[model samples]
Target: MASKTSAISASLLVAGALAAPSASPADNDGRRARGEAALARITGAEGRTVVESIRRTSPELGDWIVDFAYGDVFSRPGVALCTRELATVAALTALGNAQPQLKVHVEGALNVGCKPDEIVEIIMQMAVYAGFPSALNGIAAAREVFEKKGVRTTAMEAAQPVAPAR
Candidate 1:
């Protein structure tokens, strides 16, 4: 376990560009503060922005996300936030149909220090156990995320190569 974690930690250092996560002031103020901090560390700016919009339209859901998901669950010290987000990416990939949520968590995984290659490797491994279809979808989603985050991929570059011989 220690070796595995060390390997992952080493690889996560290669995370691609991602929006910085910011902690919003917890309205509840006590545990809220800690949770918000954890949330920011994991989800960063993207999570805050999306939650703010949710708060405007559905206060209950937004509150639940901040108070429960970020606050209570993520605040726990059993696992590192970096570990948590990676696990999330793996689970989402296994589900095979949660591309929307997978996309966000992939970014979150990066925000929490998961490298682009690590994310791809994680999903790629799932292909064998989770079957080609789910793995294929997971790869597609990860590719979209890499593109969105401006991480250059060989295929993407090939698709939009620089013009020459003008």
Candidate 2:
């Protein structure tokens, strides 16, 4: 009798595993394709690999990152990726927990047409409002990205030419 009960329990577990509604392959494909498209749109082909890595490491979070962030929020009719990246940079920089991601978004910001100067200015603004520490960390993070891309910080300073004395 105990053996029969154990067999029945095992059968039920197997059934449950078979019946579990996993994310559909088509759905997964669509999400992945959209994610790639969105990443390409914002960061170009070179940066898409990084975004793909993010997806592979955390499938569940990747779904939200791709489907929700890139698909739903980013695909909204009016808001461009550049604008969204700016907001993402600011939010991440302000939160200060996800500095790595903030660095990626800094590159995303540049890929989507945000001038380096604009990003530096945003970091400076965060320093004043979000506190010096957050801003300092944000600058450090952004600097890593700039260095990786072979962009010098002086370019940002040069872009914003100071007015000469009257």
Candidate 3:
């Protein structure tokens, strides 16, 4: 019995050793491509203007935003870009520090197929869990994007709908 267990353990160890490395050069290239694509998608004409303003004001943080946040972290395949953007948007909105990135991610969420309504809904939901202030700040940022795109939004639209008369 002990010999059988040892043999199985050895086989498992060999299999693990033979597995491909998780972070190869190819992986890095793929990540860079995804990051560039995401950057382009998020920074549409107007969004790029926002980024340029930031770069002029804070060059170091701007580099980190492009390289680390988008390149290193977002390029990973663990989660879809839409999902990641939603989470990032919510966190930043709640933290109330990075409104610029929050707006970009909101647009990113839309570019990646998340509807404007859905983004608003996420902010509303975050309000319940993260507090009114956080949600309010998030809404403020989202409002800017909606306005830029000429999307009409109201508090009633964000609320849950009631069933109509039978």
Candidate 4:
């Protein structure tokens, strides 16, 4: 069941990605510009902080993050920003070794209008493929991000009381 869902998702992502118009060589500057805007849109003010931190170590990587990740991939018209952020959150969670980046995308997920419960569900869903350990870490990351953003998780949502069986 999970494999089928994953396969369908992968197919959709590939099809949508292929549908995006390719950037031309002359679009280098344009790509950078679009990337900067996309990064700002997705990550808000933290985008600059992320870039600056990366620049302190590898300036070119920073440029690539903006120009390639944000500019070229993110700016593509196939997927909505919120959907992309959710997908990113899922991928990072599945990787299980990128807690910091996962946290960033968790925040990005919220910024792009993914509900706290929705984000939690996505991470929890990853457990099926990424294992409980990865899912647990992803939940921890999501919890921290939710705390910082002051959003409530599904764990914190109120549930209706159930009557005892007679």
- Candidate 4 — worst ten consecutive residues by lDDT sum? 22-31
Candidates ranked, most accurate by lDDT first: 4, 1, 2, 3
Question: For model 2, where is the 10-residue window of minimal lDDT?
Answer: 24-33
lDDT scores in order:
0.80, 0.78, 0.75, 0.89
Q: Which residue pairs in candidate 4 have backbone atoms (N, alpha carbon, C) closer than 3 angstroms, thus clashing?
A: 35-71
lDDT per residue (tens digit) for residues 41-140 in model 4: 8888887898989989998889889888998899999899888998999999999999989998899888888888888888999999999999999999
Q: Could you give candidate 1's per-residue lDDT for residues 68-110 as a string of tens digits?
A: 8888887888897778888888889999989988988988888
Per-residue CA lDDT of candidate 3, range 19-91, in tens? 9566643255565456555577756565556656777989756555656666778777889878887887878
Query: Which residue segments of model 3 deviate by more than 4 Å?
Result: 1-33, 46-60, 153-166
Q: Which candidate number maximizes TM-score?
A: 4
- Pitting candidate 3 against candidate 4, the one with the higher lDDT is 4
Q: Residue 79 deviation, candidate 4, in Å? A: 0.7
TM-score of each: 0.68, 0.68, 0.63, 0.77
Q: Which residues of candidate 2, in runs, are more than 4 Å off? A: 1-32, 44-57, 153-166
Q: What is the C-alpha lDDT profile of model 2 across 79-161, one tens digit per residue?
A: 77777888888888888788878987998898888877778888888876789899899999998999899876666656766
Model 3 worst lDDT window (10 residues): 24-33
State which candidate, 1 or 4, has the greater lDDT: 4
